[model samples]
Target: MTLDTDPGVAPQEEKLEMAADLTAAKEVAATDIPPELVAQSFGGYLRAWMARIRSGDSGVLPVLLGLIGITIVFEIISPNNVFLNTGNLVNLFQQSAVFMVLGMAEIFVLLLGEIDLSVGYVGAVGGAIAIQLVQPVTINLPWWLAIAFALVVCALIGAGMGFLITRLRLPSFVVTLAGYLIFNGVLLIILLLGPFSGYPTLCTSSCSGAQNNSHIIYQLMWGTIDPTVSWIGLAVIVALFGGSMWWRDSKRRRSGLVAPPPSLTFLKIALIAVIGVVLLLICNANRGRGVVQVVGVPWVIPIVLALLVVWMVLLERTRFGRYVYAVGGNPEAARRAGVNVNRVRTLAFALCSATAGIAGLLYAANQGGLSNNVNGGQLVLYAVAAAVIGGTSLFGGRGRALHGVLGGLVIGAIYNGLYLLGLAAQYQFIATGIVLLVAVTVDALSRRGAATGARA
Candidate 1:
């Protein structure tokens, strides 16, 4: 059969069109056209599509930018040059590390839509035990051994709470309440057994600013890292932050999905590096009164960063993490999906309690020692505030370890800035309360928005 073509169409043009059609067919067969090419081909027309995909997302970018803005604004306005000083800057991390741990602990129960009113006391009891185990008047165990023992004890306690809640079908509220009372008693017993030894304060003076009259546990926990941070330590942090972003983006690309722009990713890396270097430089800036220069990264800094990474990986990369979200989203559906809901919940509790124990120890260290006056209640409230203020939800199923860090940073900034401003304790407390309330309200509103979008 003779074929007649349009008079205006050349043979070359017909061949080019045929080639394009075949390429389109191949793309349809494979699916997922190269994102970069798709973007380029669509040009600005993909803006609506990109926006749709990123809708309701709560990654770290907004928080980071907001923090930068706040820091700059505060620096510009504050008198006495306190906001830009190196000492105060390093102090920010020192201040926030405890809350980071506490926030992380809360994330577990929060994810499960449960609450742990006892974590603070549980951690307090653990720290008390640690000190008692190592005090000259008590067991006199090695410091390292004491810390390990404290962690294990706390983990078991958390497990016990989980068991009580799951096996007995008791609400988390009731179980944790009983735990709070029991642990508070335990704290008293430990304190009485070994009265605040001077050794702790003496040990922590070199590490955290904690007073020596507190328990030796705190001194040992936060007192080891000097203000003089090392280049090696800074390098490790840079590597970690870089590695995380690279791996995450690579995985996303391998999964045949669009990745964030390379420029955006590199900008994140640069921001982290800048923060690390600035932190190191500030800590190393001779701000001490004595002839001896106190500089070097605090041990707590790396510890908190490490914990942040571990928790982030657990939440973002693991099947357990997805299960956590699933349980939060629809517990009944998760159960029907054959998820080991109780097991996951129990494990989460154990992890949360153990982390809290670690944080308590750090808190004690920052003080250079634990004291009978250690306000476990107030500390727990601050921790919760840090988490929510950083953007973790009180209602659950909407948080990340990074949020804890951000939230903790915000809390720390408030404390440091307010202290510099010579604000009273009452004012500080009120300000923190307000910030936390606002954060929770925002979280609830965000959840509602997500629901609305899903329905629509």
Candidate 2:
């Protein structure tokens, strides 16, 4: 039988043609898939995480909730102790303030996947200069003027470091290491000029515990507030936070973006209120024994909060923030996107130093004055640890300014709580080191999981 005359043979030819048409259709479909469509399908993995929470998976909430649970348990376990005291609680906020600011400063460099070792020493240098400027025998600048000058000088030093890193294309590790040593030397040099020869002391030698005689900067920072005023301050803070949240959420809704479910927003606000009330109650309870009654929120607390908001916005809101994240994630890509990577990196370094300077000044104020032996090296380690422990990635590209608060509070709590329990500072340091190591390890694992998900 001839093939054209055979019905079975004709049907086979038609079947082959149909198969070819199917294959062609598939090819067209594959080509028609837009790159953005492909990306969106894959990038659902990168969602902001609240989705998972709304679905009831614990995610990071467990870690935070666990910390709170532990705190409550310990509070109950040590009922008579000052752990629950309002004064100590407020002091904890004050104590952690500088660390939080320093950590934020560190965040800028960290987001670029760099480290700034000079921050501690630089802070000391800046604070010392500020103190010198305000001393009686010197320029005797007003406290405000002296502070501004000190911060500016610190910024210039940072800017200088940035210039070196960007212009010279030097490794930040080596550059900042050199800065650390040079600034430490500058601190000593600035300090040796001493008590401003004609300025009698601000207080008696006994009051200052300085044979050299010093000003009561610490007293000035914390001693002036009335005990009852802390509650008012706390109320104001709560009100502001509530107002800001409402405004932001309203903005998001108006923009036609996915607003967090109102339930989620209310939960967040409630959490803040709970924490705030607890803090205020503690502060109120811890006001006085009989003699050295201390009270009111420290000036440092508000300063730290303001800086946190600023840094948070810079990292999370602006185009600059997006660039920072991009540079940290893939510098080559950022460069292709027209970012001046070197300039950004340098600025990050400078900002870090300036922040460290602020922290240093606050540290001095916290102690009431500068001391030659103030463990700058140790403090730097704590800052780094705090940044990491609060969930920042050592590998970079995966953290936020708010993490610094988490990390700072954790660090401060460990130190203050341990001290209250009579543990030596050495043990606290050792514990911090262990916590930092664990945090880094966890972050590494998380990155691995994220990468695996991306590939999948």
Candidate 3:
């Protein structure tokens, strides 16, 4: 082409040659870049998790350890006793059900850096409404319809509170506290009037009313699926859990993303399987009173587990969940990012109330009926304590539904153990208060340590 004699042509040829060289160099550099490292074995994954814990992201480790310690202590104190008996264990599950659900309800709001003090009373109101509707002395509505009505009422109440808090810029604490009193009053009024009027005069060890144990409510609290059914259900659940974990890790690896080692994944599945089997064995044992044998997992156990799974998916897998974490982490930034912060918060409140309504149903079932004497104030406190104890941060933005389950178990164990040891009510209160204090202190220290580490 005689480029040396043509000035423009020579320049164009040189530029093209340079561009080709640069592209080749870039390709070489890209090839030289190292792949992201991930855990290649069980030991490596364990070390990674330990490192995370040391960095103040311990997750459920503390609570789990605490649970073990509590269990051991109780076992030692009640040597060769019913404290660890199958029947007692079943009772523990039933006792913890309401707390677990309520803690879950609290987590929705807590993760958003908000609190709903009224949830306990809200639950009472919901239960009362449902019970009345289904009672023969009242409208005698269908049990399903009664449940729907109660849940709807609770949701509306929650939405109203959310509106006031969001649109009116009211403090959640103050607003919810007010709601607590109002709802409690409403519950009392409901109990005192109409079908519930006869409830005041009747009293028993388990409940206050003769008509408390309606067919559906009684079944919910005391009924059990067949042992064969329980075993089958647990197996399916375990298989699903293992499969999901394996699939998630395999997908990540295929995408060239960080993934846990296959060995570690296997270990996780094994642990879950072990726990499930242990629980199943305990529940399947015959824990009889007199000649009557009680066996199989309580219906409430499956219900709580289902709720946990649903809430976990909602918080971890969805865009809305991300928005919740974002809003709690930094409201201003989230708003700037075009997230509808108010709407998220409002929805969180509504969800919290809905969960509380479910808890209320459980509570009523547990008691054989809804009563005016329901100590909602105490229950609310327990809910907060359970959530905090389970490793949810009081500061917000970092938590999971599993936290409630763990925390509720801790509370249940404590109460169950104390009862077995013949400890007084006052001791139970003191123990719970102390545990809550310790949890909060640990949470604060961990948060501070994390902040300092980040700076370092």
Q: Which one is best on TM-score?
A: 3
Per-model TM-score, in order, reads 0.81, 0.80, 0.89
User: What ordering of candidates by TM-score runs from best to worst?
Assistant: 3, 1, 2
Q: Which candidate's lDDT is highest?
A: 3
lDDT of 3 by residue, 201-312 (tens): 2112354343443556655667788999988988898899889878987897687666666666677788878888998899999988889888988889888989998998
Q: Per-residue lDDT for 37-58 in model 2, tens only?
A: 1112212322324333333322
lDDT (0-100) at residue 96 of candidate 1?
A: 77
Query: All models: lDDT?
Result: 0.70, 0.67, 0.81
TM-score of 2: 0.80
Question: lDDT by residue for model 1 over 354-396, one digit each (tens)?
Answer: 9899887877677655556766677678777767766677776
- The true-versus-predicted C-alpha distance at residue 288 of model 2, in Å, is 2.0
> Candidate 3: where are CA atoms >4 Å away?
1-36, 198-213
**Which wins on lDDT, candidate 1 or candidate 3?**
3
Segments of candidate 2 deviating more than 4 angstroms: 1-66, 69-80, 196-220, 223-241, 291-293
